[model samples]
Target: VGHLAVQIARARGAYVVATVSPGKLDFLRELGADEVIDYTKGDFTDKVRDIDLVLDPMGGDHAQRSLKVLRRGGVLVSLLDVGDNTRTQAGARDIRVERMSVVPDREGLVELARLIDANKLAVHVAKSFPLDQAGAAHAFLATKPIGKVVLSL
Candidate 1:
């Protein structure tokens, strides 16, 4: 999701800032992230500020931390939990907090397809395992792959 988001945001002309493990710094850069933070090295909030939007996949405390970087009227879109305290803090700062769930629609799919066709979007499949190797797929995912791990039928 993060990889796709980075590409989509860049394709839309956003100056994207992506945070990743040290090993993935170059990976995000290649995906068109204007700024890439090695999150394992230090706090990303310390380096980023006054942002228009933050797409947070790791919620909870991470969502709370993201609020610090958003400017007034900025938005925080979380894919996971957004605690009440985070919402209250955001409201106080005049920041909008949104929780999003993936609901695929034709319009969205078509847009994504268009992006892919234009070579503006790249899908990285780290590895694929046969359907019978579902357990192996899960284990590979647990290793924190750089891209996606798939289970093929």
Candidate 2:
């Protein structure tokens, strides 16, 4: 999700700041992230500020820190739970906090397909496993590969 978010934001002409582990810095840069931070080294809030929107896949304390970098009236969209304190802080700062969940929509999928057909979007597949190896694929996913893991029939 984070990887695709970076690409989608860039496609929309956003100046993207992406945080990843040390090994994935170059990967994010290749994905057109304007700034890439190694989250393992230190806090990303130390390096980024005054952003318009923050797309956070890692919630909890990371979500709280994300709020500090957003400009007033900016949006923080989290794919996971960002506790009450984060919401309170966002309200205080005039920032909007949104929790997002995936909902299937045919229209959205069609648009995504159009983007792919036009070479405006790319899907990063880190690994693929045969149907017989579904368990192995799940285990590999647990290792948190850099991109999507596909189960091939």
Prediction-by-prediction clash tally: 0, 0
Minimum summed lDDT over a 10-residue window in model 2 is located at 111-120
| Candidate closest to the true structure, highest TM-score | 1
Q: What RMSD, rounded to one decimal, does every model reach? A: 0.7, 1.3
As a whole number from 0 to 100, the lDDT of residue 16 in candidate 2 is 92
Models 1 onward score TM values of 0.98, 0.93
* Candidate 1 lDDT, 59-145, residue by residue in tens: 999999999999999999999979999999999999999888889999999999999999999899999999999999999999899
Q: lDDT of each structure?
A: 0.95, 0.90
Predicted candidate 2 versus true structure: per-residue lDDT over 1-153, tens digit per residue: 988888788878899999899878898898899999898988889898899999988899989999989999999999999999999999999999998987879998987888788776888999999999999999999897888999998
Candidate 1: stretches off by over 4 Å:
none
